[model samples]
Target: MIEEPKSLRIGPDVGRRPSVEQVAAFQGVPTGFVVDAMFGVGAMCVDISPLDTSNVQVAGPALTAENRPSDILATLGCLRYLKAGDVLIGSAQGWQGCAAAGDRVAGMAKNAGAVAFVTDGPMRDYDGILEVGLPCWCTGLNPGSPFGTGPGQVGTRVMVGGQPVETGDMIVADRDGVVVVPFAKIDDVAARLGAIQDMELELDAEVRKGLVLPDPIAALLDSDKTEVM
Candidate 1:
């Protein structure tokens, strides 16, 4: 008796992607604020960072891929779903020994108009990939090739960098790091960005004047039920 092969589950493309203009507005905003104070949650990837420190920033709707360990067929299949403002994010189960992509795939993804590529797994062709000029964020680089075997999914919710992501989620990435904003929260976050930046700038100006820690910190430390130990 022969074992039946596992079937690949490809979800349909989401009908709605967050506004490209609105998402792109987050390009200059620090991921620190977006993740720490704005979103008020951990939507940032803990292990993912840009492969090249080229002062590049990327913001776009997500095109998600879930690849089986050591296999990237679903990633290849996801190419058709790419648009001018899409970021291809792959969940490779956090595998670090095999590359999820390389120069060839990165070039193809760029040609398809993808703004960036991200993966929980490593990627190959670091120098060549940077030369292609597509922004990439990943755990690291590995030279091992992935199998083309089936049994992966595309355009579906997947886990990457310890965060759950869905297709069309707004992904804002820069030198600081990648921050994911759910589609439902994109507008809300965008609306709050201005006020947050305003306050941050005001506070920065005060600090630059050699101002010491403000009354809030003193009050908190002085009170605290008066416990000094």
Candidate 2:
């Protein structure tokens, strides 16, 4: 029997990264609280909400004793394209492979290279993952992650779980967590997001100083009867 592909599809190198502003504008907190320090394994997504999930897709790397995708190798290869402070914010598919522990991948990532790893699944090697100083982002910790058919195919748009990830994409990660951008839209998005972030920081400073505003946002918050948090 012939296997059919999933309706949602993406190709590698489509060229675009979600701008910080774009993602921030559409950001929503996950239904279940995600741990600040998770194993960094499951998958990656725009939001846990039903409306915000579909953003990027990632096909995980295939692994085995002899054919495992090396975190060190991928980091070395990715470094040529990424800066020392750059981030890798796509989804992972290792959860599909239950044979090996998540630590193996985390170790690879921690010791491998790049800023850090991000996923929506479980993660292992908490000690090693943290020790490496590769700040990670993930949903939860899965003891083991499964494998996929193969590795990145040069810009193939594969959904790590809910989010979409393409090859050669720019990623932004910080205390709030990780964000992935498509290669095509990095400049425009980054520039815009910079502005938004600055504005927010400015507002945050004022709020800290007891600045009060009956602005539209305040009205909405005052009127809202229900809150998720």
Candidate 3:
């Protein structure tokens, strides 16, 4: 493991971000579809989830932070760089025993014009966090506060939930899970997302019409690739 920084390594606010309207169009679309459109391989985070798992979705440009275990100073430092429609993505190292942040920080993010806050660690002040009403995503809940120690990095690529998230990358998250789109790939993926949605809608219409199994499934079921005694 690399030694932690003696002080914060704060970089300039990232300039690249996904098109707002294009990202907003992804609301209510399952993350699985976006992941598939990325060619089944891309910056998809694992394990973390929306704080409100039922009927909540978030999409915005990432503003990343790297936090030490049980410490949030780095996370807090990143707040200075927040912009409207930004999603704060913190690499909490998947620590669950201590809060990644609390309602106070959540409110700060809201005040700073952030669209949401996400981490692979837990957060405290559950009721207050809800009251603040900023969309939050994490592994779970923890009541203990994290230390405000030095040795953190901000505004850089950080690994959270097993994926690399660079500042200004697009983040689309819903009940299914969070997906990160590299800054360079946003337009390319957005270009394909519509076709995926169209296909899914067609399949959905077929299911509603009582058509059982689409052509792909039917073909697979009858193909020589399958055999049974």
Candidate 4:
């Protein structure tokens, strides 16, 4: 039997990932409530944007269909922290039988009540796992896994969907995209992200109104513009 490598082993914070958990715990939330609490709201584009899960469908003799899933243990270690309205998308990573591992994780998310898994890669196993009813996103499908890396330290920071994921991190996904939220300094970072979003939004509105926000950035305009200059 091949022994699991310690280089990228799963730890205790499987359910909420890692960074997400810290944000949730920091915010004094129930962890499960991070979603409703506005966790995954704005992190859409960066989500599946980094993924590529394409050939995830299967074809029978006459009927062709997509393969979905629900493999719980492969997802959250205990799943006690999962709740409804949660989304768990897969991120792309190079590993042995990697697609299958991601598929298994996606299945687990659905079974544990997460909304979906956004993988940039594909899975080899399908058909049987489609009933979990969870959504998935990726580039193509393959039935292999490298499995040497992912989040190593439970409850620590790692990337998912091109964004950092935490244990209590809020995940929101749709056809539009996926996102990980409630950054570190939960109560503070979340507000900061919100402010940034607002600033961007206001900028967009200003552009439409023919009123651009003042460019506060000053450029050093000469080859000798260094501080010494």
Best by TM-score: 1
Error of 2 at 5 (Å): 14
Per-residue lDDT tens digits for candidate 4, residues 1-229, read: 9866443344354444334333333232221233334544435333243233332221000000111232212234323445554544333432223462344555665676655555444554565345544556554456554343322333344454345555555544443454445433355544444445566678778789897345542344333564652
- Please give, for residues 1-229, the per-residue lDDT of candidate 3 as tens digits: 9875577888665555666676676666677788888987653455687887668877888999888888898889878888888999877888888999999999999999998999999988989999999989898898998999857888888888778999878888888788888888877888888899898889889889999778887898899987877
| TM-score (all chains, Cα) for each model | 0.92, 0.51, 0.91, 0.46
For candidate 2, give the lDDT: 0.41
| Residues 85-104, model 1: lDDT tens digits | 79999788888879999999
Candidate 3 is scored at a TM of 0.91
Better of 2 and 3 by lDDT: 3
In model 1, the runs with Cα more than 4 Å from the true position are: 1-7, 224-226
lDDT of each: 0.83, 0.41, 0.83, 0.41
**Candidate 3's error at 35, in angstroms?**
1.3
Per-residue error (Å), model 3, residue 187: 0.8
Off by over 4 Å in 2: 1-101, 110-112, 145-155, 215-229
Q: Tell me which of candidates 1 and 4 scores higher on TM-score.
A: 1
Ranking, lDDT, top scorer first = 1, 3, 4, 2
Question: Candidate 1 — worst ten consecutive residues by lDDT sum?
Answer: 36-45
Model 1 Cα RMSD, 1 decimal: 2.1
TM-score of 4: 0.46
Q: Candidate 4, residue 96: CA error in Å? A: 6.8
In model 2, how many backbone clashes occur? 47
